[model samples]
Target: MSATATTTVTATDSPRKGRSGARPLHLPGGISLRVERRALAVGVLLTAAALALAVVLIGTGDFPIAPWDVVQTLLGNGTPANDFIVNDLRLPRVLVALLVGAALGMAGGVFQSVSRNPLGSPDLLGFGYGSAVGALVVIILFKGGATEVAVGALAGGLLAGVAVYLLAYKQGIQGYRLVLVGIGASAILIAVIQYLITKAQMIEATRAMVWLTGSLAGRDWAQVWPLLAVCAVLFPLVLGQGRALRMMEMGDDAAHAVGVRVERTRMLLMLAAILLTTAASAAAGPISFVALAAPQLARRLTRSPGGNLLTGALMGSVLLMVSDLASQRAFGADQLPVGVVTGLVGGIYLLWLLVTERRAGRI
Candidate 1:
């Protein structure tokens, strides 16, 4: 063989027989786990901030416990009034906010990672609308209560997700196609929801109206239990599939080359995301923007290339808790829906993302 050809053979073969049985030198998917370390820090900071905001708001309630009193109550040493304000009312609300936010964040992170698009979220993809459609159907048709409505929402979100997947699969499930199809599906569901709202009595509409806005008000342990069920089931399932999800960002063929079941993995992740979103929506009526905004904010905070699931969940919880606080305090007579507050902020952020993408020539 020619010297150059011999050299090329040696160079190619050498790495295939390294000290530890000849391994690939490259990081998986041209991405490094090193970046995710900072994600942990960002998640912690965001969680602390969220807790602080919740505490501050709890202390400033109608009863007005001091910060110290709030701490004492949290630690089981405060006055009865302080305990009542923090543990009974505000604590449950905060816990719900955190749970809902975490679910949205996790769902959003999964969707964004799967789609490889920052804009792909449960809210934007119509999953939230699916939940609404389901809940509305139960509320209107069956006169179901909150629990029943929640189940309907879950079923609706899953059905919508499946429909989107089937529709988007015709062309090999391109990211943009999936997003577009999901958006269209969501519009149809929204129309159905509107129709249901119109047909229902005003009293019935009152419940739907409150649910539509995604408020955490009146969410006691009952709502919290269902959310817990969802988290308990879905959280670990998603985490277990993280490696497969990471593999998928490199496109189907590449993921498959690494022994990842690309289609199955994507489908499972999508389903999990749907379940989480549905559970959250059922609990709090499609609380807006946490699913859309948290992951993006997490990426920014961690200075990572894209979303981190853990960090996104923490950021989401914080965002929701802070929004809830604002809603409770900012309006004197009428407490605004937490979802509305998140939607306003998230909408602006979405616009900003669009502008940034355009500026970066990604459009």
Candidate 2:
């Protein structure tokens, strides 16, 4: 009943195990471990690629520094000018982009696994719309600063998620029901956001519009620190329940039969992923498609089942970093927000996804 239900064997035959070459390595104290070699390899490669992209991003800004210089600056061994450019200026923005992407990727994986659907993402869960509502409310009505807007978005996203959880709880929540309720809530939240925009002054409306695009611009240590702190806590918390989550993906009855405590694990994953998604949205204004696409991409790349949190996290970071690079250098002198780049790519990806789903008769 595991995600890798590739083969079945009866008691008269041999012990049941996946065809994934997942042999148990007996440790001292008779502890055996099952590691999916391909998946782990994929995760390692992704981490390397993400780091390489991060270095490229840090080094290729307006005041360009060589990759070596960027590394040296990070190590406190570069000249003051290079140090300022790499450490003081570009590093925070790059970190924010990487962290936000990783958070979104992991959260998306959790949601998708929980719902047993590829489209199960923060936006589909209404968290992104809810966060947008909070941010727009601050931008339009309160005339708030960047920090205030972020705080508002976080609060709004959490509230929206709570509401969806509550509404979907008919004795207990089902994955499809949760997604449906969240979609309904998202529609309402989208309307609220539009209304807020209509009521704003021209300047406020413009500000709101830009934020809605989900950029990583003007980011500094201030944004990076808190997001890092949140990811630090929530990432492990989510990963710790990965086994239970995979079991739940099989089905509630099967999971319960295996002592999986399906409901509690589901609740834990949902809450953790909510915090992760909201934190990422608040940090970078809901950069489109990372949550929706990262997990699926990682799954495909690894050719593995279940959440694949670590691989997704790395893929998300790399995807966001590449988009940020495209925004900064691909266009002419005029700078583009990272969100615009992501949106364009995400749109195409979503179309492809829809077509695939339709062909598969899963839509």
Best by TM-score: 2
lDDT by residue (291-343, candidate 1, tens digit) is: 88888877676654433676777778888888888888888868888989998
| TM-score, every prediction | 0.87, 0.93
Worst 10 residues of 2 by lDDT: 5-14
Error of 2 at 153 (Å): 0.8
Model 2: residue 235 alpha-carbon error in angstroms? 0.8
- Please report, in order, the local distance difference test score of every candidate based on alpha carbons: 0.77, 0.83
Show pairs that collide, candidate 2. none
How far in Å is the alpha carbon of 289 misplaced in model 2?
0.9
Across residues 90-120, which tens digit of lDDT does each residue of candidate 2 receive?
Answer: 8999999999999999999989988888888
Clashes of each: 1, 0
Poorly placed runs, candidate 2 (over 4 Å)? 1-19, 23-32
